[model samples]
Target: MTTKNLLVELFVEELPPKALKKLGDAFASVLCEQLRTQGLASASSVATAYASPRRLAAHVTHVRSKAQDQAVLQKLMPVSVGLTADGQATPALLKKLASLGADVSDPAAAVAALKRQGQGKAEALFYDSLVKGVTLDVGLQKALDEAIRQLPIPKVMTYQLDTDCGMPHFLPGWTSVHFVRPAHGLVALHGDTVVPVKALGLTAGNATQGHRFEAAKTPVVIAHADAYAQTLRDDGAVIASFAERRGEIARQLAARAAEVGGGCRPIEDDALLDEVTALVERPNVLVCQFEPEFLEVPQECLILTMKANQKYFPLLDAQGKLTNKFLVVSNISPADPSAVIGGNERVVRPRLADAKFFFDQDRKRPLESRVLGLAKVVYHNKLGSQGERVERVSAIARAIAQQLGGEALARQADQAALLAKADLLTDMVGEFPELQGIMGGYYARHDGLGNDIAEAIEDHYKPRFAGDELPRNPVGVCVALADKLETLVGMFGIGNLPSGDKDPFALRRHALGVVRMLIEKDLPLDLGQILATSAEVFGERVFTSGPMPSETPEGSIGIGSIGVKIDPETIPKVRDFIYDRLSGSLREQGYSAQEVDAVLALRPQRLSEVARRLAAVRTFAALPEAPALAAANKRVGNILKKADAEVQPVVRPELLKEPAETALHAALEQVASVADAAWADGDYTANLKALAALKGPVDAFFDQVMVNADDPALKANRLGLLATLHQAMNRVADLSRLAA
Candidate 1:
């Protein structure tokens, strides 16, 4: 058996750490799928991808030299031009034909068209366009070229443009190769001799280098990808393995921390570690010490300042207490790391001093004292000021607390919500934006409001990203939900909703945060009511914007701020935007688009409740007969959809006649009884099954009987029966929206 290997590499300027893994995995998976779809065979390996700040590479072994060609057919749908009655292509059709590359002006082409052949069969039309008939064992080189050409990267430029100029890629226009990074060169060598990699206008060689300072040059020639990686490592740098880098760093960190009478715990920053590892060919962990006085500043401020700003890992003692020392993973082994440690400590000292100043200033006047200052800080001119939002949040939180029945915590939640945004205007939060909620919690604790209030202040921003933690305490949950709701209402009030990847306000994050708290924390607060109250706060702003210039009250104050008069129509529009956010949020949890429609049809007041009903229906949908039941639902749905097409019919039992109609009616009655009992008990699965049982009878009734009969009395009876089915079904879901 013959064997071939494929290798691709890219070298470029340093990439943003965030785009590394995603770009690496995308190139490999997209290329692999494209290859298989194009009929390449005997490919049984994953393309091993390696990514760094400046380079990305992929290696595929056991690659076939040729692709297994298969026939593909295309269809020529009827053109808009008229055809002759005898099924001949007409003069008008021929006149417009040249637009599609048909040489209709030629006598032979016109004659063939006038004769009319090769109609109806999709394959025949496509086959005629092919320059050659389907042949076996087509060259794999062409397939690889085609696949790579189609890989979509958000940004690309071409160094060398091919003859067929498509959209310019995210690389140099003259560069006729596709690479996620710069392709310094390709190396397709076999032993000492170089193998040709000229298929896509690329040539391979046998030269590589190691770390610049340690081993800048190597006199080795690599024949294969595996050997190439090993040779580089043998020279001085460990190449090709992220696991090895992580292990080396962890080992050094552990031994160093042990010397300090403690051990380094891994921070929850895999992304940071990955980028740091890529910065060096060899990773050496160095533990650096700082003055313990910095510990007086909030741990979050110190840790975030170190990790987010400096890319350093903070250390912890055996008891999980924060230590004055931190671990800095370096690319090169420094001769005097004490200098490195001292440099980092000096940089961090000023940051902590800023934190200390904010803490001391904030405590001198409690967070509540600063709440009035937020009134001058406008959140959105149309949505009211920051102080107004705080009041709205307080109301929303208290209502949520009342719903959860934490009277005392609910009151504390109201106070916490009012004070939450007060930290936004603080000096510390201005420097470290991520520490907004954390600092609020710290200041609250310093004021002796205790842990619950302090936690509520911090927990309000519990989930800053997907899969992040949600508020665990009830007060925290209320405050968090309130905070997100206020932001959503305010931003949407100003018509600043996210549009096509442009979200200046981070509304998507706020919406998702609301979803996480509702679903993960299982907060039972209704979103509809909360939005209504918040909307009222906005509505007042709208009304105060002044009604259409009226004759009365001519001397009254004119209402307009930041050039927008908050009109009545804007409130419902903003509310609909919130609903859209809710539907999208629920869609991420594996709910079908139709399921989202069904649950949303119920006019959900609370986002958490909306998620619950959707979850219940989703679980119920997985039962053995779910699809069949959904099919049955479609039948009942059709009858009801048509019946209620004009108006929703109220079931009037008096107009009953046909046995089939009566039987379906009685079955619906029994189902309704079960549905009510289950719905009241919150057993939606049982309710859905009970509703599903009506599908068989519904199908039979629809087949055996007609609803729009000649007799008016009998027609009303049948319509009433369909209406009864609709009412029973709506209890579980708006099955009328179910797909056929």
Candidate 2:
């Protein structure tokens, strides 16, 4: 079979800008896969995707014109049913042969045609046939049809097709079809030949329209499969390849920014760049400027309006400050671009004016005044209004502040938490919800609040996402921690936990935020104590449902979990949930499972000490005596666990009958005092390292003594000595976890 490059394109009205790249990639990959499945292409075939605002096309190389013929063997029937006593063809054999379209004119010849294979219980008759190969036209039609059916369109559009679309498969009357967009033309070419495929009520042809306005020709003609991209570019006044067009736009943006001088460059945002690339085919980047006074508004507001509303790239100086000038990616290229630049400027003025008006008007009223409006806004049906949530947060903030910074920080935290959600009622935030916290900071400053209060209001939602920065100051830290804890405890108290990928309440994000602040900020706050105090703000009546469901992942986290619902008893589940999240984080940071498990199993109160504890464990595990000590630790634990009664962890020197027990008891006094001193001073590495000195005595005691003595006093004394040894060795981490 001969092979050639293949090209297929769907010409339609403007496609969605954000979904264009995904649609193109999906269409090409699925089409190529179908060809390979049908044996029309090989594994080595290459597929290239091209997507623009008005078209989606794919070019596949090394596609065969026809699949190779195949040899097939099929089981007919048992040998007994096909052959009789005289070896003549049975009536069932003749009927089965006729159904298969096999030659059945002579019974004897047909019987001889099938081969017999004898087996123990049953022998079967097999028929062999040569199946003809499939032509490329038939294969591509199937592939094209399958490709259209499987496109990951964000939304489907239904439209009526008329005779003008030249759909050969349809009559002269109108027909309705559904697709991502309305199709006006379809092109499918195999080498130099046109593939007569039908899709979306349109027939495939070699001609397609390009660049609705500035194309050099009405209908661009592709002569061959390999010439599709080049011809479309030369004759259609469009850049068919999406990547090529995006690169050109970026190059033009950089060049134009340099031309503006003062070390200007366009803001870096890949999502914005991709959307602009999809909106134009042949990009002509032109510089445009807005009023210099509009920069009075926050640069976030200005930059957001330009990128989100106008689809323009705002320029910034070397200092990363927004300039009065921005760039536009126009689809048309004219001899003179002054008209385009002026038109863009005129269009953006009203947008900036609206923002400035909102800003100026918002400053007239204080953020504290807006606090009352939050009473009417619903946060959750089960959980009260946003106003109620604010009160809870304020209380939690005060409690946390008193613990960390006393009355001074508590006052600032209370003020910030009180007005943190106030911006949600602002005019600017109403227009763009993304500016919720940002608007509050500006308004707080306008109301004569101190920088501490203003900064805290702005950063109360800090570390909102993974790798996001934490709050800047101590006051900000207090409010931020309070805000996240309130959301977590409130949601979990309501039995609204995240199930699978469906985190409608964003509980996972909120939980992760708490962990980040606790660990990264190195705040010496106890997670359990804070969570308990936070839950107390809601009172005992806050829980309105039952236990967490067994199906939720929360059930598996160390605490007792039943079916998920709101209940007062479920409050303890938060500790397990937070620690579960921490364990995963530690593993991601390159700590071994044994290392993480050993340190976290003890549930240390201070998160700041966790890193130090892990470092200490790593250093101790590298010691030459660590293996024997770890194994001995495991044995001691088992012995203590199997004690007939609770063997008190007290060693009686008077009851020490054996030399090994005497030596071990002496070693604990010498080594354990030092380990305890180091642990008390937060020197965890020294604490664990001090245990390595006792390995020799530990091995001697285990080798020479039997823990289960016939006399209860001897057994108790041996057990107590081992208990003292266990306590000393595991002060930093559970050494038994290190055992294989």
Candidate 3:
């Protein structure tokens, strides 16, 4: 069968910049998928997607004008029900054959033509027939409709169209049409011929409007399915493919930055590039500059306002310091180009001025002065004002600091925690809540506080997102841990837990932050104790409250004010929650699920040692003695569990009656001493490797010595020996988990 390439395009108003890429890919994928499903496209076909600010298009190769006819076999009814004992036609069988348009006019012949197989009740009658092929016109219409329905449109708009289904109308008789935008044109082509299809009340055609103002042709005409992209680019003065347009923009940005010399480069941000790519069809990169005075403001404030408010890329010098000049990706190119550059420079001056003004005004009041203002702001109706929360955080910080650092560290941490949220009241932070910790750090330096306190305040919210860096100094770590733990304890205590993806309180992120800091920083703090201290600061009311919070103010013996009414299970649940977060983190770092599962099963209190334990487990699993040891360990655990009385690790040597038991007892004593020494030195790998000595004894003991010996004393002694073996094997990780 012969095939020709196919093209489909939807020209609408500008799409949402963030959703444009997803919408375009989805449109192309679904349309081609539907075509293949209908057999109008073959396995050899390839689909290419094209998206611009105002258009979404797809081109497919090896698409047929009409799908091939297919032979189909359909099951009918049970053989016994369809035919009589002698294989004669039954009335019911003839009726079913008639419904299927089989030649039931000759009922006996039709029944004779049917095939039957299987035995007894499983036997069934089957019919075979050839289905008619579908033409491109009918198939394209179905595919086009399905593509539109499946688009990941961020929002939808409803408009009206006339009776002819080709033009918009607001008249009484018009039909309502809903879509991402009011689509003005639709194009569908097979080779050079138009495939007459309609979508969103628009008829498919060969002509589509290009760039709103800069097109070389009024309505760019696509001559053929294969020529669509080239013709549109040359006549429409627009880059039709999103990837090509983005690459062009990036290349221009880099070339222009190099021309600027002095090692200048545009700040790298992929998200910003994607959004800019979605906002333009023909990108024209231009250099623009602001007054040097604006540079006096923290570059964070200036860079943020430029990127967020104006969508411009600020240039950085060799030291990674922001310069006065920035690059803009304009949508138009002019003969002189001076006017476009001037217009952008003029537009950005006011935005930069506002940032500088906010910075200057904010520095006048020390962060300590703004501390009182936080009391007026609502931290949470359940957790009281931000001031009360600050106090709880300070208390937690002090407790953690005393354990990690000393009096000097505790004092500085306490001070940093107190001033951390004060920036929420600043004009700069008020305008951009994302700059809360950042602005506080800047203001702290102006108040004559040392860099230690300033950096701690700034980094209190370190790791606001995944892959973000942790606190810089010990003070920062102290405050960051305190703040996160306070929120977690308060929220979990009051039952404000996260369910599914709906984390309004970001409890999961907060827990993950705690885990990362402990493990990565190798902090010696106990997670359970830290949580208990955080809970202690909240006092009796919060923990003792019913299952749900009281919905009342805190400090009044009301469980509701502290948040929800949590039960006794709250603490354990929170602890489990943190470990779950740890498990996921470890897996993402390339550890196997079994290794992580085994290590976490023991509930290691000091999270800093988790990695060492995992490494040890991996080493042990590879040893020749590993499989037998792990299996023996599993058997030992089962025996201990079924023991009628408690099986202690302590064994009475005199009761070691069996020879197999005697050998295992002596092996464990020697292995335990070596493993204990390795464990003491934190040589977890060596500790686990030392267990290779016990494999022979363990296997022999399990095979020869009966754990359930008829004499109670003998059985107890054997169970004690197994119990001792189990404990020795699991110090680093539960080896039984490695068993297949």
Q: Write the residue-wise lDDT of candidate 3 on 96-185 in tens digits.
A: 888888998886789878887788899999999888899999999999999999999888998776555644553535577799888888
Residues forming the 10-long window of minimal summed lDDT in candidate 1: 122-131
Model 2: residues with Cα > 4 Å off, grouped in runs: 70-133, 164-175, 540-568, 624-648, 653-670, 693-726, 735-740
Cα lDDT over the full model 3: 0.89
Candidate 1 is scored at a TM of 0.72
Residue pairs with clashing backbones, model 3? 494-564, 547-565, 548-565, 549-564, 549-565, 550-560, 551-560
Q: How far is candidate 1 from the true structure (C-alpha RMSD, Å)?
A: 8.7
Name the candidate that leads on TM-score.
3
For candidate 1, the per-residue lDDT at 96 reads: 49
lDDT ranking from best candidate downward: 3, 2, 1
Q: Which stretches of candidate 1 lie over 4 Å from their true place?
A: 1-46, 52-191, 195-205, 216-226, 236-243, 250-264, 334-354, 376-378, 381-385, 398-411, 500-504, 516-525, 540-600, 604-706, 709-711, 735-740
Model 1 lDDT tens row, 1-740: 35455554444455456666566555556545554555442457556666555545555665554454343333333432344445456565555455545576564454354322355632122213322322112433343454456545556644453434333442445556545444444454323335444433444566654565665456334556657567667763645454566667767767777777755464657777766766656777887777898788778878888887778888887777779888887776778778877777788777778778877776787887888888766565456567777888888788778778668867888888888888888888888888888888888887888788888898888677777888768889888877777777766666776889898887788877876676666666666566666656544443223333332266876466344334456556655766677788777767899889978877665555665577667776666656665665566566656763543555566666556666787788887888889889978777777766676677678778877888876776676676666667777566556544
TM for every model, in the order presented, reads 0.72, 0.88, 0.95
